[model samples]
Target chain A: MPVVGMVGGGQLARMTAAAAVGLGATFRVLAESANESAALVTHDVAIGSHLSLPDIAAFAAECDVITFDHEHVPGAILAELESAGVLVRPGSAALGYTQNKLAMRERLSSLGVPCPRFAPVVSVADVEKFAAGSWPVVLKAVRGGYDGKGVWVCDSAVEAAEVISHGIPLLAEEFVPFRRELAALVAMSPSGQGAAYPVVQTIQVDGICREVIAPAPGLDPDLAIEAEAMALGIAAQLGVTGLLAVELFETRAGGLLANELAMRPHNSGHWTIEGAVTSQFEQHLRAVLDLPLGSCVPAGTFTVMANLLGGTDPDVFDRYIHVMAADPTVKVHFYGKEVRQGRKIGHVTIVGGPGDSVESLRDRARRAASYLRWGTEDGE
Target chain B: MPVVGMVGGGQLARMTAAAAVGLGATFRVLAESANESAALVTHDVAIGSHLSLPDIAAFAAECDVITFDHEHVPGAILAELESAGVLVRPGSAALGYTQNKLAMRERLSSLGVPCPRFAPVVSVADVEKFAAGSWPVVLKAVRGGYDGKGVWVCDSAVEAAEVISHGIPLLAEEFVPFRRELAALVAMSPSGQGAAYPVVQTIQVDGICREVIAPAPGLDPDLAIEAEAMALGIAAQLGVTGLLAVELFETRAGGLLANELAMRPHNSGHWTIEGAVTSQFEQHLRAVLDLPLGSCVPAGTFTVMANLLGGTDPDVFDRYIHVMAADPTVKVHFYGKEVRQGRKIGHVTIVGGPGDSVESLRDRARRAASYLRWGTEDGE
Candidate 1:
């Protein structure tokens, strides 16, 4: 059996481990602690930090291919593994683009990909200069930021300078006044075969993904095709060997501007678990293994996925029985984590048939997710 | 986390472990060896035989509820566990019917469920007498027989006498010349709620289930409804708390006769893994855990599942890439076992769309299974 080593032990890795079992592939996870979601279920877990070179080397020694559950692993460590012939997928070069916002902007812009105009900033002066063309610019940390962290919207140079006192490497970009956010996910094998999932409308609140609807209901056929083509183009250009999520701004003017990039399984694709011909997690495993990719066609007419953020309820398991009994069609996924306010503990997916309304699917998923989080059917 | 301890470590337990992860439930398996299929993937494995009383006790103590992967766990041991207050789903009384074919036949007959005429025999003379009425009788060992083992079809008293010399507890039954074999799978909860899956046609090769087609193509609608009703009635009567697979023979006269019973996940329902809204393995977990059972509605227009029996090839992983590439929609499941001649190593399932032909679906599943078993697309 070929061993696939994952560098993180989050819910993404937990799901990947489940998919690995079906593939008859041995899965190993390097966890910072035994309590991480994936570590709790995976059989082979190495308790180590991603920052430790020796830990990375030890974990890589046992795997036929090394991949990641998150892109937080330093680029130097991944580069080291690659030099040692460890077969790190979505290799360090591709990860470098996702790891740093400025690098991704530069690369995509240079490739003539549609993207928000951006420039690396040393001080507020640079931000002011960039804002000369577009006011109310968005300033984001170059690296090590996620879920609303390390990002700020500044209307003027003084406001941007005050926020920059945190001393983080910053990049300024044109604030996209988009009608909605969409994500196009694609999986590519090392052998150059790629498969694209339908473009999905992603709802984000406080920079945390709240829900996703597949195929972006009523999306223009031409724009959907263009988004998929753009995502595929980026994956090819980056030589990304697993799932690549291109978060885009669907501007009111009917054009797409690249917003962000994620090179692993993304929250926007969670609906694929039950709604698509092949799940993104399964496709990622196949891609990293250089195996033939599975079909990415939608299995149902519509799919709605809602994240279950941790609320006051400490025991989500108690609510499972109720949620399941309420809607037998809703698929529930729980990430084994201690309940902390606003943390993502799990998600619910509801797939609708051709005759079913998307509004009903979305309501059912949201209701199920709310019940799980609050232990009430009214979905407060 | 509530721990579910399973008493056997076959593919049934392996699939259940995967489902348990989705439920955020802790799954523990008591395996006879470390090399059992479920033992390889499951994290909490007790390497002890189910036959050992102390081992069963130790395993049961760690679990909130107990179940079985196979019906081979001795009834007395289960009774002892029950006496000790360990919760065992489908309790010892229910498993008793499945463990002893004569017991199942007797119970079904007394309950007025249709079944073949059967009699327990102690000697060759008794077998000879039973065969006198039927001409050709099927003799089966009363216990510990599976996959065509311990079964013999004797045409005459002389042949019956020769086969009975094997010295196993035997039962003789009238051989029903049937049109085909069918299975009705139902999931029941301790609360008396029951859900039935679609009746399926099962193809048996040498008593081993080789293929199964859901909703039994060309099956009479009335007969299908009757089969489901019978299965649900049997589950409620037997007090079976998990999955009950009631294998039946559709007589040449269009009547249905009970053929066999399995008190756990059965091979015939494997198609539900991808073909139905809820998989049998997931439903089993829900039923055993006393949670609400999921929907049993089929997810596709049709589904065909084919077992991948081990052939001359020892390396199944090598053929997986080809099988997956050949048919991306075929869901492959490997038992993670070394290949041996005629052993069931894995299975493949294919779901058809609204416009797809069942024949094409069956052909695709068979070709995938054959390629996995023999590395040939022509299924030779």
Candidate 2:
């Protein structure tokens, strides 16, 4: 059996390990701690940091291919692994675009892909120059930011200057006033076959994804197709051999612009676990291993996913019985993590049939998530 | 978190471990060997024999609730665990019925449940007397029979006399010329809440389950309800706390008769993995932990599951890429076992939408399984 080594031992890796079991493949996770989600489930786990070259090399030595649960690995380490002949899906070259915001913007721009105007910032002057054409710009750290961290929206150059003082390499982009954010997820194999999941409307709060609705609810079919095509195009152009999530902004002016790129299973595709014929985690495994991708057809007419953010109560098991009894059809997934307010602990997914509406499914999922998070049935 | 200790570490235990992860619960397995299916995946594994009382007692001490993957454990051992105040789902009293065929027949018959006429047999004379009423009788060991093992079909006293010389405890059952074998699966929590999966038609080969069709094609709606009611009745009467599989015979007379009983997850319910909202594995976890049972609603119009029996090819991973590419909608489940002739290595499940016929779904699933088993696309 071919061994797949995942760089991060988070929930994504944990789910992927479960998927790999079905394929009878060896799945190894490199974890910083023994208690990490994936490390707890998988038998072949190497306790190591993703940043340590020796640790990564040792883990890679046992693996036929190296993939990732998160895109936090340093590009240099991935490049080094590539040079040493270790197969890394979404190779260092493609991962470079996801590792640094400026690199992604430059590459996408060069490909004539729909993207917001962006500029690398050495100082506030760089932001000011970009702001001359579009005000209220978004400032982001070039690397190492997740779940709303290292991102700032500034209305003035003064705010941009204050952010620049943080000393992190920065990039400024024209902040599109979007009606809603959408994510297009696609999986590609080294053989060049691609599978696209339905475009989903991602609900973000404080720049963190809170919920997602497959097929984008009432979005035009043509737009969904266009978004899927764009994501497929990005995966093909980047030579990405795994799941590619293109987060797009649905501009108020009736156009879509790519906001970010994630080269692994993304949170926006979580609903696919129960709602689609094939899950993103399984597809990722198949793609990285250069196997054929599974069908991306939705199993239900409407599917909704709501993140189970940690709340006041820490004991989630106590609430599980109540949540399960309340909504018999809802699927609840919990990441083995201690509860802390606002942390992504787990999620709930619900699928509605053809006769059911998206709003009803969303409400059911949110209610289930609320019950799991805070033990409330009313979803407060 | 409640730690569930499963006595046998087979595929049932392996899948339950995966389900326990979703519930944020800890799962432990006691396997006779380190290479057992569940032992390979679960983090907490105790290498011990199920027959060892000391080993089971030590394993039970670490578990909040103890369950079983197989019913091979002795009744005295389970009774001992109960006496020790260790929580055991489907307590020893109920498990006794599944462990001994004569006991099951007596109990169900006393309950006025529909069951095939059966009697204990000490010699060929007893079998001859039973055969006097029913010509063709099915002879089975009172204990320790599985997958066609320890079973015989006696057409006359001469045949029964030859089998009696083996000196194993025996029982003779009236052989029903049935239309097909069907299974009704139910999960019940300690609180008495119960959920039932759709009745399924099980195709058996040499007494081993080969394929299962959910919703039992051509089954009368009233008969399906009756079978579910009977299964639920058995669960309640027997005090089965986790999964209860009631194997039935649809007789030529158009009524159902209970054929066998399983206290744990059974091969017949494997279709629920992709066909039902809550899989049997997950439902078992929820029920054993005294949590609310999840819904057993079907996910699609129909579903077919076919077992992947090991064949000439031992390299399953080598064929996975081809199998997945050939049928994108088929969900394959591998048991992580070395292939051997006639051994159940894995299974494949495929769901059909409203527009698809059950015949088509079964064909697709069978083709996928054949390809997986023989490494031939044409299923030759």
What candidate 1 gets wrong by more than 4 Å, as runs, is A378-380
lDDT of model number 1: 0.90
Supply DockQ values for each candidate.
Answer: 0.75, 0.75
Runs in model 2 deviating more than 4 A are: A378-380, B377-380
How much DockQ does model 2 earn?
0.75
Q: Per-residue lDDT tens digits of candidate 1, residues A112-198?
A: 899988888888888888888567989999998888888888988778988788898999888989999999999999999999999
Model 2 lDDT per residue over A1-380, tens place: 78889999999998887777676677899999999988877777899999998999999999999999999889899999999999999899999999888988989999889998888898888899889956799999999888999999999999999999999999988888899999999999999999999999999989889999997988988889999999999999999999999999999988899999999999999989888999999899989988889999998898899999998989888787778888889898888888899899899988888788888888888888888788886754
**Tell me, what's the RMSD of every candidate?**
1.3, 1.3
Native contacts retained, all candidates in order:
0.65, 0.71
Cα lDDT for residue B238, candidate 2: 92
Cα distance off (Å), candidate 2, residue B45: 1.5
Chain A TM per prediction: 0.97, 0.97
Model 1, position B174: C-alpha lDDT score: 94
